[model samples]
Target: MSETDTLRDNRDRGGPAQPLVLAQNLTKHFPIRSGLLNRQTATVHAVDGVSFAVHKGETLGIVGESGCGKSTTARLLIGLIELDDGTIVFDGDALGSAISLRDMRKSVQMVFQDSYASLNPRLTIEETIAFGPKVQGLADPLGRARDLLGKVGLDPNRFAHRYPHELSGGQRQRVNIARALAMSPRLVILDEAVSALDKSVEAQVLNLLCDLKDEFGLTYVFISHDLNVVRFISDRVLVMYLGEVVEVGPVEAIYGKQAHPYTASLFSAMPSMDPDNRTMEPPLSGDPPNPVNPPSGCRFHTRCRFAEDVCSGAKPALATFGNHPDHLAACHMHDPASGHSLAGAEASA
Candidate 1:
């Protein structure tokens, strides 16, 4: 089946067009301290002015290499880590004004990659899932946990009393998914949630996730290095490089016509089933720059194939590219005024 047919239609959900989660100018820098007194040293630019939105009932996929801040961005979204500088708006209310951090957390939950570590070995399957609801003082947390277990394809009768070590990797991840759903959260940040599973098991979990999203009316922020998986599950795709969002657009648009050089290169690296259409040469070369001391202007300029003098000097703001609807890219090639020679006014507009 086509992605359009499989994914839920979230364009009109019987309300205002406002995004369910709005993040603007989100920046996070980790201080590197050393010496006897732990003096402040250089900062790791973990996330630099990253911004995007998660619409209600839509799965937003974030794809980037290691140290690109995908996990850090996930932490910031759900308040796992305090933001150095940024504003998060959840459900049309500014965080500090109408909603407290604690309150926002109840509406958001995260599922980490290491399912075994995420759960307490002491807690049984049922107890692990019930813990979140219990903290909220919800009545019948155990009952809710059992129901979620069934929804996630784990027969509660069989798995409820088992420990984390007794279950397979796939089963453990299912328990993690059930636990995330325990809070009845509107948004769930899944940080590499399925990357560790085998192929057949991964497909099962992916389908389970889609089923749960439809049944519970949930939104997801799926972060992973697997391009094929991201394309399969996401409604919109956001491309990041060196802690910056280089491009974001509908899933089909990103795969069909990638505007940024890094994005095109990333997609080109995806493994294909067709032997005749295999990638002849590597699309990307050279290691990514260090986050502590990144390049000037565009962080991607150093590795970008289409890099020019202007690209190394002027930072390109994320803007609409060409006539593609809702497509945005942070590259001089997409901005006419940036004077990269390849830019055009229509794309910049």
Candidate 2:
């Protein structure tokens, strides 16, 4: 079926639609080398068996700590890094097989955290935005770039001639967005695209993103450490810990009734405006275990307060709990038959 037809079909379903991008068992590990020969000693488990999906025209926010492999996952999806294992299916086409790398690049574009670093310092704003379309052999590249600048709320006549260094952080980011959209991609992987901007500028960029998404029928995989921004922009949220997916659900479901202890801890860490309401128990304690020698079974067991013997012995599969079939968590506590109760569980919003 045509891409538009597929999108229409999914929209007509009136429920959770089929994923536009489906990643299953995605794994990427970096080898640790030592000595003169640089012989591989141990492997750093970056992304281990992580799996998730992004529905058409939906934003899937991936949130985790600094070394949680959110960036690696984004790079993997866009073919920036080679996957050691697993499969990525985009728009019903399996990557690396049915879809060629070039075609995949055309369909999926990425926006990095550092807008200045991502852009060419030498190129003018117009040139930078038009480069992608030019490389793709698209007609009227300059015209399209100018049009896109306007679409992204930048004045084409005024800002188009300026360089990356000349524009503000927020403006540069908007150019980055326009550059990504120049390819007419179906999916955009935003790796902390707005985290570096000022709050006011970030809001403006976010609003622009929302408008552009609706205008272009775009699907997004938004990776960010900022929970508030993620909550604002994402329809669904995926929580990752130690290179593994710990929870997946709608934003409201995950935030209102967090099922996973790690997820609860993350929410607990989110600074609240009400200073009177402080978290009693520390959300997290101690450093994360070294990825080179990761702990067995549940990766979060070392830090989770609700951890049990089973948690360290056997890995809990990500599964739905009770009536919330759409919300899934990888935690032994979610299993009622496993002699676990939610009596003392803390829900974070």
Candidate 3:
């Protein structure tokens, strides 16, 4: 079957016949040290039992506010940080067991938010793109770099020799993309990769990303705070709050009918173009609670307008809501069997 056909089949089946990457019960916590002796006083629960899968040739957009573990999840997927608990299976091989870290790095790459900071100021654009392939002892590193520049819409002849300092923010970001593609990875983790650019430039970069994904047959884990961009680029969307995935489903399911209260609040915050059609729901009341001492049951209950007594007493499992088995949410209001309605609760004060 053609790759496109295969991808479509997988989507219809909820995921690929075999996922390119699978993370189960992923968890990460940073120890907070205090006092002169530097005793471990508290733990920062960066990623709390997060689980998800990336199918081949699919873009999974992760959306959440800052400190919601979007970037941390990216880092963990790429092996930039060690996981406190979890198993990462990539292309049928479990990470740290059958697959070595070096092998994983070659097949999975990442592009960070700050293009300028990620690129070496001293290195020319060509050199920056060539560095990865050179380290891996790939043949014709410079040729590959020049080819990538052209593929990403940058003229190799005109831009190859320029340093990152000489390029505009958009240009530098394109170069960053070239660098990530140097390894020809199967999956690319984009951690707010276009969040810093101007609106026009952001559109250009987003389009470029779409083109590259098709050209390379690549799967992407796109993490961003911009809901519109996430809706535009992602095939499926994962909604996280304070290190936990509160909801996950196809893009249509997420935008068309969100199940989690946190996910609904996020959509409500988006400004409407029509002045007369303002959202009735209030904006998120307060900043996300401190991650170190996150609330017991539902971490988002404190800020969720629909929150009830049950929401604070017992944790909800991420499960299918109603008849939509593919659309999952962690909320007490949804019962897998009966599909209880909580829409009225959301409308209440």
Q: What is candidate 2's lDDT per residue for 1-349, written digit by digit as tens?
A: 1444465454333244667888999999999999999999999999999998889889999999977889999999988999999999877778888888887898889999899999999999999999989998998899999999999999999999999999999999999999998888878999999999999999999999999888878889999999999999999999999899999999989988788889988888887778799767778997767788788989998998877778888888998854567799988876655544542242211
| Pairs in steric clash, model 2 | none
RMSD to the hidden true structure, all candidates:
4.5, 3.7, 4.3
Residue 319 of model 1: what lDDT? 90
- Which residue segments of model 2 deviate by more than 4 Å? 1-17, 337-349
Candidate 2 C-alpha error for residue 214, in Å? 0.6
Local distance difference test, each candidate: 0.88, 0.87, 0.88
Error of 2 at 282 (Å): 2.5
Q: At residue 120, what lDDT does model 1 achieve?
A: 98
Per-residue lDDT of model 3, residues 1-349, tens digit only: 1543465344332245788899999999999999999999999999999999998889999999989998999999999999999999987888999789888898889999998899999999999999999999998999999999998999999999999999999999999998998887778999999999999999999999999888778899999999999999999999999999999999998899888988988998998878899877677886788789889888888887767777777788998754567789988777433233463353242
Question: Model 1 misses residue 25 by how many Å?
Answer: 0.7
TM-score of every model versus the real structure: 0.93, 0.92, 0.92
Rank the models by lDDT, top first.
1, 3, 2
lDDT of 2 at 308: 79
Q: Candidate 1, 288: how far from true, in Å?
A: 1.6
Measured on C-alpha atoms, candidate 1 has an lDDT of 0.88
lDDT of 3 at 270: 91
Q: Which ten contiguous residues of candidate 2 have the minimum total lDDT?
A: 340-349
